[model samples]
Target: MSLTSVEALTQVRARTLALVAHLDDADLERQVDPLMSPLVWDLAHIAAYEDLWLVHRYAGEALLHPDLAARYDAFETPRSVRGEIELLDAPGAREYLRDVRDRTLQAINGRGPDGVLHEMVARHELQHTETMRQAMRLGGLLAPGEPHLDPLTGPDGWLDVPAGAFAMGAPDGAFSYDNERPRHDVEVGAFRIARRPVTNGTWLSFTEGGGYQRREWWSDEGWAWKEDYDITHCPDAEAGHPDAPVCHVSWFEADAFARWSGGRLPTEAEWERAATWSQGTDPLQAVGQVWEWTSSWFGGYPGFVAHPYREYSEVFFGRSYRVLRGGSWATDSRLATTTFRNWDLPQRRQIFAGVRLAADPEVN
Candidate 1:
């Protein structure tokens, strides 16, 4: 059954609230990392976005609180400086969110479905839910009750993705970010990819074998990043247990580890092919264990066009960022689809990032 716009919005809003229910006032206000917004900021931002898009843009209503436009404008204030901004306290933030949601829901009910804006807000909130979860995990304040990925129970081996042309991006008919557009065909040569993400135990071996100390396994840029950051091992290796996928790894680190294992990070095309393969029995597991790094740079697809949320994809189409596929444990399952494209700077390590090995068919 298709979900009515109101139902979808309510479901996603409930999930957003549930993710923050366990946090205390202090937890809500704390900025866990330089890269992530504080929980309170995120809370207000969700409401702010809903009001901005749904209430103001879709329903033709005036802004509930005009003062909030600049306060919660993410594009204006960088994450590093959010804590210093005069954000609402926990109670105030909740009150503001309640107000915005109340007004937005009233408009939705009165006006009926407002086309794709409802779904757009729902997806936006869901993405922030994952961001908040990552902040909680990084802060060591994550509630134990949150959902987790299942253990690596799938068959242990590499899956051979045959050499051929395959449909590469999200086709028309679904709501996908602009970067996943045009549904073009991509020619990928036969390659083998592990069924699961690289685990902490595997990464530990790399560290013990001097993976970080040796420059041969790393690209010149990667080696510089490693040295500049003084990264000797996975940032959270001591915290994450051995069997878990390593988290807080940069693309450079992921690249070095793949090379050290006599493999390489899969290109975006190979990763997507393995993920979307339908020819044989499905052979992937623990896809949401972590955001697996890919060799591809973040760029516009052929004939790419900006969607309604222009900055969502257009702002990052360059060599400055590398692509990541799949999703992390913090990701909402709805946003963790095969066609979703996530990218970050190669030097960023705070997010729930990890690696999956891929190799040429002959090498395997």
Candidate 2:
């Protein structure tokens, strides 16, 4: 039998709690950069979302602890402050996450999955997972250590996929955000995509090679951002490390680099096909390696409809944000679904963002 609702949630919560345990108090509240959040804020935000969705929204119950509501408001959008979010002590926050998860499971058990709250909790967790990954990257938590292929490691070789028509989007029974609605079919010609994302070493080569200085390599808009930001980094403009996933770049930046290298960003169709339609029995599932920026916009699929999470995708459907596929190392493993979509402004890169090359090999 498949895992029960409570069992599934419990397991995921346990894993997330462990991931948070790795950071010290100083790391938890460090926000030296504007693009990243204090890790303490992450903890508080997850608990607050759980309380909002599971307890109040779903069960018609009050918040687990009523006094914490004000703290939630300050966390919705990214902040530039660089100090302790004093309300969220490390030891206390972990205990709160556990209590919230356990009580949510109890509520689910009592309700027998009859209400909408179960699915809401699941979706909320997915968002937190993505945010957590970004925080980890900013904190320098992903320092090279393991053999595991993180977003920062490009595979030594390529993974070639044969041409075929693969079903895309979320199927029924699995709760998906509105953005993943109107499941459709598209043909994907055989193509080779990097098994991992572009690494720091490789990206550094582009910078050292005057990839940024040469207008020939940049698109018109990309050149504008380069000039506007005054990014003359033959040595160090200090955006991020050579080994860290390159964040805070515009689509134009990614596009220019891809073009200079004889490749281009993957279209949304190509990206989803690669991610959701993997070969063999294992379905495409790469949640916490890297957040891949796709050529697709955040617009709805063919037959889109709004859902309860109104702002989830609707607010940023246009060119304001580019589409990002896959979750990053800081992401919660359980929060990701093949159909999940995350987006951010093209120029903002304080997250676990990176790119992998995709192109027509015959032409190359």
Candidate 3:
């Protein structure tokens, strides 16, 4: 059953808090890497985001912590400097979350609330929860526990998608980011996509066979990044399984692996078409396990218009960022809808990401 807007918001808030429940002051405050903020900062930032959307934008109310806006605003303060900023203490951040949620509840219950905005805010928190987990995983703060991956699934090989036309992107009135808007028809040639994502075992084969040393397999920029970072393996390789879809694989790594495996990364449209088909007889497995890199760059749909704020999606539409589909283990299941566009630097391997290969129908 679909949750009431209030229920969804409440549940997302609960999950956000639960994610950080055991972490104490020091852990929450520590910045594990420059790419991510301190966990406590994330907590406050979540609160601040809710306050911005719910209390300020939706409710048209006075700011609760207006003074802290400069500090907590994501664009105003980038991740590189977040660790140095003096943010609310862990307990204080929790209190801020509660306070913001209290106001959010009032806003949603008072008048006919814009359920779409409520959903957007709820999903925003959900995304942040995943971000917080990324920080936890990287910081070695998470306790030893079972991974979310399942054993190998689906048919042993490829799923063929015939040459055809299909409507791409989410339709109007749906709950999706602006990047997924302006649904349009697209034509693609016949291709075969993997039944399952490329697993750690497959990736390990590449690395063991000197995949990193073989410069020919990597793009010029990709090889440069590999050598610059001295990156040799995924972050948690010791804990990974041959069956589990690889995590922490960057677009560069995914591309190189695809080349080594005699395939290529699927374009965003192909990925979407396959995902749409996955719903029926043409089943695709191991989705929502890790964000799958696509061969497409992050760009606006043809008729894209920035809704509410340009900062959300418009700012990042460009060649510098590569598109990723699916959702990671830490992702809230609801947010992994087919058209939800995710983008990051091609060289960023810190986020939980994996690869899926595609090739011409005749190749296999």
Candidate No. with top TM-score:
3
- Taking all chains together, each candidate's TM-score versus the true structure is 0.95, 0.77, 0.96
In order of lDDT, best first, we have: 3, 1, 2
Whole-model lDDT per candidate: 0.85, 0.67, 0.86
Q: Name the TM-score of candidate 3.
A: 0.96
Residue pairs of candidate 1 with colliding backbone atoms: none
A best-first ranking of the candidates according to their TM-score comes to: 3, 1, 2
True lDDT of residue 351, candidate 2: 51
lDDT of 1 by residue, 66-132 (tens): 8888888888877989988788999988898889989988887878766567887888889888788
Please estimate how well model 3 matches the true structure, expressed as its whole-model Cα lDDT: 0.86
What is candidate 2's lDDT per residue for 132-241, written digit by digit as tens? 66566555664355213433433354556668887778787766778888788888887766655665667778887888888998867768887998976523124445
Model 2: residues with Cα > 4 Å off, grouped in runs: 65-67, 73-88, 91-95, 114-116, 141-166, 187-201, 232-250, 275-288, 332-337, 360-364
Over 4 Å off in model 3, which ranges?
143-146, 278-280
Q: Please tell me which model should have the higher TM-score, number 1 or number 2.
A: 1
